[model samples]
Target: MALPASSFPTLLFFLFLISHPRCEAAESFSHYCSYNRPTTPAISKSIAKVLSALVSKNPPKRLNTVSFGGGKSKVFGLAQCHRDINATECKSCIEDATAQLPHLCPGQADAGAWFDHCFVAYDHERVPEQHGTGF
Candidate 1:
Protein backbone atom coordinates (compact mmCIF):
# COMPACT_ATOMS: atom_id res chain seq x y z
CA MET A 1 0.00 0.00 0.00
CA ALA A 2 1.27 3.45 -0.96
CA LEU A 3 0.77 6.43 1.36
CA PRO A 4 -0.26 9.86 0.18
CA ALA A 5 2.46 12.54 -0.12
CA SER A 6 0.82 14.70 2.61
CA SER A 7 1.32 11.92 5.15
CA PHE A 8 5.08 11.67 4.48
CA PRO A 9 5.93 14.87 6.31
CA THR A 10 3.86 13.90 9.34
CA LEU A 11 5.47 10.45 9.43
CA LEU A 12 8.93 12.01 9.19
CA PHE A 13 8.18 14.38 12.04
CA PHE A 14 7.02 11.52 14.26
CA LEU A 15 10.19 9.59 13.50
CA PHE A 16 12.33 12.60 14.32
CA LEU A 17 10.55 13.10 17.64
CA ILE A 18 11.34 9.57 18.68
CA SER A 19 14.93 9.61 17.43
CA HIS A 20 15.92 12.91 19.00
CA PRO A 21 17.11 12.76 22.58
CA ARG A 22 14.99 14.82 24.88
CA CYS A 23 16.21 16.52 28.04
CA GLU A 24 14.41 14.39 30.58
CA ALA A 25 15.40 13.18 34.00
CA ALA A 26 19.02 12.25 34.57
CA GLU A 27 19.87 8.63 33.89
CA SER A 28 22.38 6.57 35.82
CA PHE A 29 25.33 5.16 33.90
CA SER A 30 27.66 3.57 36.42
CA HIS A 31 28.55 3.53 40.12
CA TYR A 32 31.34 2.41 42.42
CA CYS A 33 31.40 1.74 46.18
CA SER A 34 34.56 0.91 48.06
CA TYR A 35 33.89 -2.14 50.17
CA ASN A 36 37.26 -2.08 51.92
CA ARG A 37 36.35 0.86 54.12
CA PRO A 38 33.21 0.60 56.22
CA THR A 39 31.55 3.83 57.21
CA THR A 40 31.37 4.92 60.84
CA PRO A 41 28.59 7.17 62.16
CA ALA A 42 30.78 10.23 61.93
CA ILE A 43 31.84 9.37 58.40
CA SER A 44 28.21 8.77 57.49
CA LYS A 45 27.21 12.16 58.85
CA SER A 46 30.00 13.78 56.87
CA ILE A 47 28.90 11.97 53.76
CA ALA A 48 25.36 13.22 54.24
CA LYS A 49 26.58 16.75 54.67
CA VAL A 50 28.73 16.52 51.57
CA LEU A 51 25.90 15.14 49.49
CA SER A 52 23.55 17.79 50.78
CA ALA A 53 26.03 20.49 49.92
CA LEU A 54 26.50 19.09 46.43
CA VAL A 55 22.76 19.23 45.83
CA SER A 56 22.00 22.54 47.53
CA LYS A 57 24.84 24.68 46.23
CA ASN A 58 24.54 26.18 42.77
CA PRO A 59 27.84 26.66 41.02
CA PRO A 60 28.68 29.25 38.39
CA LYS A 61 30.47 26.53 36.47
CA ARG A 62 29.39 23.03 35.64
CA LEU A 63 31.47 21.44 38.38
CA ASN A 64 31.43 21.84 42.16
CA THR A 65 33.32 20.27 45.03
CA VAL A 66 32.44 20.19 48.71
CA SER A 67 34.21 19.18 51.93
CA PHE A 68 32.65 18.60 55.30
CA GLY A 69 33.70 17.65 58.85
CA GLY A 70 37.30 17.25 60.08
CA GLY A 71 39.88 14.61 60.82
CA LYS A 72 38.79 11.00 60.28
CA SER A 73 35.19 12.09 59.84
CA LYS A 74 36.01 14.45 57.00
CA VAL A 75 34.39 13.79 53.63
CA PHE A 76 35.07 15.28 50.23
CA GLY A 77 32.63 15.30 47.37
CA LEU A 78 32.36 16.46 43.81
CA ALA A 79 29.39 17.02 41.51
CA GLN A 80 29.53 17.95 37.85
CA CYS A 81 27.14 18.25 34.96
CA HIS A 82 27.85 18.34 31.26
CA ARG A 83 28.72 21.83 30.07
CA ASP A 84 25.96 21.92 27.49
CA ILE A 85 23.18 21.56 30.08
CA ASN A 86 21.60 24.62 31.65
CA ALA A 87 21.68 25.40 35.37
CA THR A 88 18.30 23.84 36.05
CA GLU A 89 19.23 20.72 34.18
CA CYS A 90 22.55 20.57 35.98
CA LYS A 91 20.83 20.90 39.32
CA SER A 92 18.39 18.18 38.49
CA CYS A 93 21.16 15.92 37.32
CA ILE A 94 23.27 16.52 40.39
CA GLU A 95 20.28 16.04 42.66
CA ASP A 96 19.48 12.77 41.02
CA ALA A 97 23.07 11.60 41.25
CA THR A 98 23.31 12.56 44.92
CA ALA A 99 20.02 10.90 45.72
CA GLN A 100 21.13 7.63 44.19
CA LEU A 101 24.60 7.39 45.69
CA PRO A 102 23.56 6.37 49.18
CA HIS A 103 21.37 3.57 47.94
CA LEU A 104 23.86 2.45 45.32
CA CYS A 105 26.76 2.49 47.77
CA PRO A 106 25.33 1.93 51.22
CA GLY A 107 27.78 1.40 54.12
CA GLN A 108 30.82 2.34 52.02
CA ALA A 109 33.01 5.25 53.00
CA ASP A 110 33.89 5.96 49.35
CA ALA A 111 31.40 5.93 46.53
CA GLY A 112 30.74 7.45 43.14
CA ALA A 113 27.85 7.55 40.74
CA TRP A 114 27.93 8.50 37.06
CA PHE A 115 24.81 9.72 35.36
CA ASP A 116 24.02 10.59 31.77
CA HIS A 117 24.28 14.33 32.41
CA CYS A 118 26.22 14.49 35.68
CA PHE A 119 28.58 12.72 38.08
CA VAL A 120 28.67 12.54 41.91
CA ALA A 121 31.36 11.18 44.17
CA TYR A 122 32.24 11.26 47.86
CA ASP A 123 34.99 9.86 50.03
CA HIS A 124 36.31 10.03 53.57
CA GLU A 125 39.60 11.30 52.15
CA ARG A 126 40.01 14.15 49.72
CA VAL A 127 39.36 13.36 46.08
CA PRO A 128 41.50 14.66 43.22
CA GLU A 129 41.12 18.38 42.48
CA GLN A 130 41.17 17.74 38.75
CA HIS A 131 38.28 16.20 36.87
CA GLY A 132 38.60 12.98 34.81
CA THR A 133 41.67 12.02 36.88
CA GLY A 134 39.65 9.32 38.67
CA PHE A 135 38.80 9.17 42.38
Candidate 2:
Protein backbone atom coordinates (compact mmCIF):
# COMPACT_ATOMS: atom_id res chain seq x y z
CA MET A 1 0.00 0.00 0.00
CA ALA A 2 1.32 3.56 -0.82
CA LEU A 3 0.87 6.35 1.74
CA PRO A 4 -0.11 9.96 0.88
CA ALA A 5 2.80 12.52 0.74
CA SER A 6 1.50 14.50 3.74
CA SER A 7 1.25 11.35 5.82
CA PHE A 8 4.81 10.38 4.83
CA PRO A 9 6.23 13.67 6.15
CA THR A 10 4.36 13.29 9.46
CA LEU A 11 5.62 9.75 9.88
CA LEU A 12 9.16 10.85 9.06
CA PHE A 13 8.95 13.64 11.61
CA PHE A 14 7.89 11.25 14.37
CA LEU A 15 10.67 8.85 13.46
CA PHE A 16 13.25 11.64 13.55
CA LEU A 17 12.00 12.80 16.92
CA ILE A 18 12.42 9.31 18.38
CA SER A 19 15.68 8.34 16.66
CA HIS A 20 17.65 11.53 17.31
CA PRO A 21 19.45 11.93 20.65
CA ARG A 22 18.45 14.62 23.13
CA CYS A 23 21.18 17.06 24.15
CA GLU A 24 21.41 18.32 27.72
CA ALA A 25 23.87 19.55 30.32
CA ALA A 26 24.87 17.00 32.92
CA GLU A 27 23.57 17.26 36.52
CA SER A 28 26.11 18.46 39.08
CA PHE A 29 28.14 15.70 40.72
CA SER A 30 27.78 15.00 44.47
CA HIS A 31 28.74 12.30 46.96
CA TYR A 32 26.92 10.48 49.72
CA CYS A 33 26.51 12.10 53.17
CA SER A 34 26.70 9.92 56.26
CA TYR A 35 24.66 10.94 59.28
CA ASN A 36 25.61 10.06 62.81
CA ARG A 37 24.50 11.10 66.31
CA PRO A 38 23.45 14.68 66.83
CA THR A 39 25.93 17.07 68.44
CA THR A 40 25.52 19.35 71.41
CA PRO A 41 25.04 23.05 70.78
CA ALA A 42 28.68 23.83 71.55
CA ILE A 43 30.06 21.19 69.23
CA SER A 44 27.69 22.25 66.50
CA LYS A 45 28.83 25.84 66.82
CA SER A 46 32.46 24.82 66.58
CA ILE A 47 31.77 22.75 63.49
CA ALA A 48 30.07 25.68 61.82
CA LYS A 49 32.89 28.06 62.69
CA VAL A 50 35.62 25.77 61.34
CA LEU A 51 33.73 24.99 58.16
CA SER A 52 33.11 28.69 57.56
CA ALA A 53 36.82 29.38 57.92
CA LEU A 54 37.67 26.66 55.41
CA VAL A 55 35.30 28.14 52.84
CA SER A 56 36.52 31.66 53.38
CA LYS A 57 40.23 30.87 53.37
CA ASN A 58 41.02 27.75 51.39
CA PRO A 59 44.60 26.52 51.88
CA PRO A 60 47.31 27.32 49.33
CA LYS A 61 47.58 23.61 48.44
CA ARG A 62 43.78 23.16 48.20
CA LEU A 63 43.74 20.44 50.91
CA ASN A 64 43.03 21.45 54.50
CA THR A 65 42.10 19.52 57.65
CA VAL A 66 41.62 21.36 60.92
CA SER A 67 40.20 20.88 64.41
CA PHE A 68 38.32 23.45 66.49
CA GLY A 69 37.25 23.75 70.13
CA GLY A 70 38.52 21.38 72.80
CA GLY A 71 37.61 18.19 74.66
CA LYS A 72 34.08 16.84 73.99
CA SER A 73 33.12 20.00 72.16
CA LYS A 74 35.92 19.74 69.59
CA VAL A 75 35.05 19.28 65.93
CA PHE A 76 37.17 18.02 63.07
CA GLY A 77 36.81 19.28 59.51
CA LEU A 78 38.43 18.73 56.15
CA ALA A 79 38.10 20.27 52.72
CA GLN A 80 39.80 19.48 49.45
CA CYS A 81 39.68 20.45 45.79
CA HIS A 82 40.74 18.62 42.68
CA ARG A 83 44.44 19.28 42.09
CA ASP A 84 43.83 20.16 38.44
CA ILE A 85 41.46 22.97 39.38
CA ASN A 86 42.76 26.52 39.80
CA ALA A 87 42.68 28.39 43.12
CA THR A 88 39.70 30.54 42.16
CA GLU A 89 37.60 27.62 40.90
CA CYS A 90 38.54 25.52 43.93
CA LYS A 91 37.51 28.30 46.28
CA SER A 92 34.19 28.70 44.51
CA CYS A 93 33.45 25.00 44.65
CA ILE A 94 34.40 24.80 48.33
CA GLU A 95 32.25 27.80 49.13
CA ASP A 96 29.26 26.31 47.37
CA ALA A 97 29.81 22.98 49.07
CA THR A 98 30.14 24.50 52.55
CA ALA A 99 26.98 26.48 52.04
CA GLN A 100 25.08 23.35 51.15
CA LEU A 101 26.50 20.98 53.78
CA PRO A 102 24.47 22.08 56.83
CA HIS A 103 21.24 22.07 54.85
CA LEU A 104 21.92 18.64 53.43
CA CYS A 105 22.95 17.04 56.72
CA PRO A 106 20.92 19.01 59.22
CA GLY A 107 22.07 18.38 62.82
CA GLN A 108 24.03 15.23 62.25
CA ALA A 109 27.36 15.20 64.14
CA ASP A 110 29.21 13.50 61.28
CA ALA A 111 28.46 14.55 57.75
CA GLY A 112 30.21 14.86 54.40
CA ALA A 113 29.37 16.39 51.02
CA TRP A 114 31.29 15.82 47.84
CA PHE A 115 31.01 17.79 44.59
CA ASP A 116 32.56 16.90 41.24
CA HIS A 117 35.53 19.18 41.91
CA CYS A 118 35.65 19.38 45.69
CA PHE A 119 34.73 17.65 48.98
CA VAL A 120 34.03 18.57 52.62
CA ALA A 121 33.63 16.56 55.81
CA TYR A 122 33.11 17.23 59.52
CA ASP A 123 32.87 15.05 62.60
CA HIS A 124 33.22 15.12 66.37
CA GLU A 125 36.33 12.93 66.32
CA ARG A 126 39.49 13.31 64.29
CA VAL A 127 39.79 11.49 60.99
CA PRO A 128 42.13 8.56 61.45
CA GLU A 129 45.56 8.51 59.87
CA GLN A 130 45.99 5.76 57.29
CA HIS A 131 48.85 3.27 57.57
CA GLY A 132 50.79 1.61 54.75
CA THR A 133 48.92 -1.06 52.86
CA GLY A 134 50.35 -4.60 53.07
CA PHE A 135 48.38 -5.94 50.14
Candidate 3:
Protein backbone atom coordinates (compact mmCIF):
# COMPACT_ATOMS: atom_id res chain seq x y z
CA MET A 1 0.00 0.00 0.00
CA ALA A 2 1.00 3.65 -0.27
CA LEU A 3 1.87 4.56 3.31
CA PRO A 4 -1.00 4.74 5.77
CA ALA A 5 -3.52 7.45 4.83
CA SER A 6 -3.61 8.56 8.45
CA SER A 7 -0.08 9.90 8.32
CA PHE A 8 -0.37 11.51 4.88
CA PRO A 9 -2.36 14.53 6.12
CA THR A 10 0.07 15.18 8.97
CA LEU A 11 3.06 14.88 6.70
CA LEU A 12 1.60 17.23 4.14
CA PHE A 13 0.65 19.73 6.79
CA PHE A 14 4.15 19.76 8.21
CA LEU A 15 5.65 20.30 4.79
CA PHE A 16 3.29 23.16 4.08
CA LEU A 17 4.17 24.88 7.30
CA ILE A 18 7.85 24.66 6.55
CA SER A 19 7.57 26.08 3.03
CA HIS A 20 4.64 28.40 3.34
CA PRO A 21 6.75 31.44 4.07
CA ARG A 22 8.10 33.20 7.09
CA CYS A 23 8.33 36.82 8.15
CA GLU A 24 10.85 38.16 10.62
CA ALA A 25 9.28 39.19 13.86
CA ALA A 26 8.86 42.85 14.75
CA GLU A 27 11.98 42.54 16.92
CA SER A 28 14.12 41.16 14.12
CA PHE A 29 14.14 44.44 12.14
CA SER A 30 16.78 45.85 14.48
CA HIS A 31 19.51 45.06 11.99
CA TYR A 32 18.14 47.97 9.95
CA CYS A 33 18.53 50.66 12.60
CA SER A 34 21.32 52.96 13.85
CA TYR A 35 21.52 55.85 16.33
CA ASN A 36 17.73 56.05 16.50
CA ARG A 37 15.23 56.90 19.21
CA PRO A 38 11.56 57.47 19.93
CA THR A 39 9.81 60.10 17.77
CA THR A 40 6.56 61.97 17.59
CA PRO A 41 3.72 60.90 15.33
CA ALA A 42 4.18 64.00 13.22
CA ILE A 43 7.84 63.29 12.63
CA SER A 44 7.21 59.70 11.80
CA LYS A 45 4.46 60.58 9.38
CA SER A 46 6.57 63.25 7.72
CA ILE A 47 9.57 61.00 7.28
CA ALA A 48 7.42 58.28 5.83
CA LYS A 49 6.03 60.70 3.29
CA VAL A 50 9.45 61.94 2.21
CA LEU A 51 10.73 58.42 1.87
CA SER A 52 7.80 57.53 -0.33
CA ALA A 53 8.76 60.13 -2.94
CA LEU A 54 12.50 59.81 -3.00
CA VAL A 55 14.25 59.52 -6.33
CA SER A 56 17.49 58.61 -4.64
CA LYS A 57 19.00 58.16 -1.18
CA ASN A 58 22.61 58.22 -2.19
CA PRO A 59 24.92 61.11 -1.48
CA PRO A 60 23.32 60.88 1.95
CA LYS A 61 20.47 63.22 1.17
CA ARG A 62 18.01 63.98 3.95
CA LEU A 63 15.08 66.19 4.94
CA ASN A 64 14.40 67.07 8.55
CA THR A 65 12.57 69.44 10.87
CA VAL A 66 13.85 71.27 13.90
CA SER A 67 12.42 73.02 16.98
CA PHE A 68 9.44 70.86 17.71
CA GLY A 69 7.24 70.92 20.83
CA GLY A 70 7.52 74.73 21.11
CA GLY A 71 11.37 74.78 21.03
CA LYS A 72 13.12 71.55 21.84
CA SER A 73 13.38 68.33 19.77
CA LYS A 74 15.32 68.91 16.61
CA VAL A 75 14.78 66.22 14.00
CA PHE A 76 17.93 65.31 12.15
CA GLY A 77 17.81 62.55 9.59
CA LEU A 78 19.83 61.30 6.62
CA ALA A 79 19.19 58.45 4.17
CA GLN A 80 21.77 57.06 1.79
CA CYS A 81 21.74 54.25 -0.71
CA HIS A 82 24.23 53.27 -3.39
CA ARG A 83 25.31 56.08 -5.68
CA ASP A 84 24.92 53.70 -8.59
CA ILE A 85 21.21 53.33 -8.11
CA ASN A 86 18.91 55.22 -10.44
CA ALA A 87 16.49 57.79 -9.15
CA THR A 88 13.58 55.41 -9.52
CA GLU A 89 15.21 52.58 -7.62
CA CYS A 90 16.37 54.91 -4.89
CA LYS A 91 12.91 56.29 -4.53
CA SER A 92 11.44 52.81 -4.19
CA CYS A 93 13.94 51.81 -1.54
CA ILE A 94 13.31 54.93 0.50
CA GLU A 95 9.59 54.33 0.31
CA ASP A 96 9.98 50.75 1.36
CA ALA A 97 12.37 51.58 4.17
CA THR A 98 10.18 54.37 5.43
CA ALA A 99 7.11 52.20 5.49
CA GLN A 100 8.99 49.66 7.52
CA LEU A 101 10.78 52.08 9.82
CA PRO A 102 7.89 52.98 12.04
CA HIS A 103 6.98 49.37 12.38
CA LEU A 104 10.58 48.41 12.93
CA CYS A 105 11.25 51.02 15.58
CA PRO A 106 7.70 51.49 16.83
CA GLY A 107 7.45 55.05 18.15
CA GLN A 108 11.19 55.55 17.70
CA ALA A 109 12.33 58.99 16.57
CA ASP A 110 15.57 57.91 14.96
CA ALA A 111 16.12 55.03 12.55
CA GLY A 112 18.13 54.19 9.49
CA ALA A 113 18.48 51.44 6.91
CA TRP A 114 21.47 50.79 4.68
CA PHE A 115 20.35 48.73 1.76
CA ASP A 116 22.50 47.54 -1.10
CA HIS A 117 21.48 50.60 -3.06
CA CYS A 118 19.92 52.89 -0.50
CA PHE A 119 19.90 54.11 3.11
CA VAL A 120 17.48 56.06 5.29
CA ALA A 121 17.56 57.86 8.62
CA TYR A 122 15.42 59.96 10.98
CA ASP A 123 16.20 61.39 14.39
CA HIS A 124 15.76 64.23 16.83
CA GLU A 125 19.18 65.81 16.73
CA ARG A 126 21.53 67.75 14.50
CA VAL A 127 22.29 65.53 11.49
CA PRO A 128 25.33 67.19 10.11
CA GLU A 129 25.84 66.99 6.37
CA GLN A 130 29.59 67.08 6.74
CA HIS A 131 31.85 66.26 3.76
CA GLY A 132 29.31 67.79 1.42
CA THR A 133 28.14 64.29 0.48
CA GLY A 134 24.72 65.44 -0.48
CA PHE A 135 22.99 65.46 -3.84
Tell me the TM-score of each prediction against the true structure: 0.75, 0.69, 0.50
Per-residue lDDT tens digits for candidate 3, residues 1-135, read 688989999999999989876642122223344434556666655555544434333324543222222223445555554566776665556566656665666666656555545555565555523223333
Sort by TM-score, best first: what order?
1, 2, 3
Deviation from native of the Cα of residue 118 in model 3, angstroms: 0.7
lDDT (10s digit) by residue, model 1, range 4-35: 99999999999999988685656677888889
Best-to-worst ranking by lDDT: 1, 2, 3
- Flag the better candidate by TM-score, 1 or 2: 1
lDDT at residue 131 of model 1 (Cα atoms): 37
- Model 2 off-target regions past 4 Å? 1-28, 128-135
Structural RMSD, model 1: 5.4
lDDT of each: 0.83, 0.73, 0.52
Error of 2 at 123 (Å): 0.8
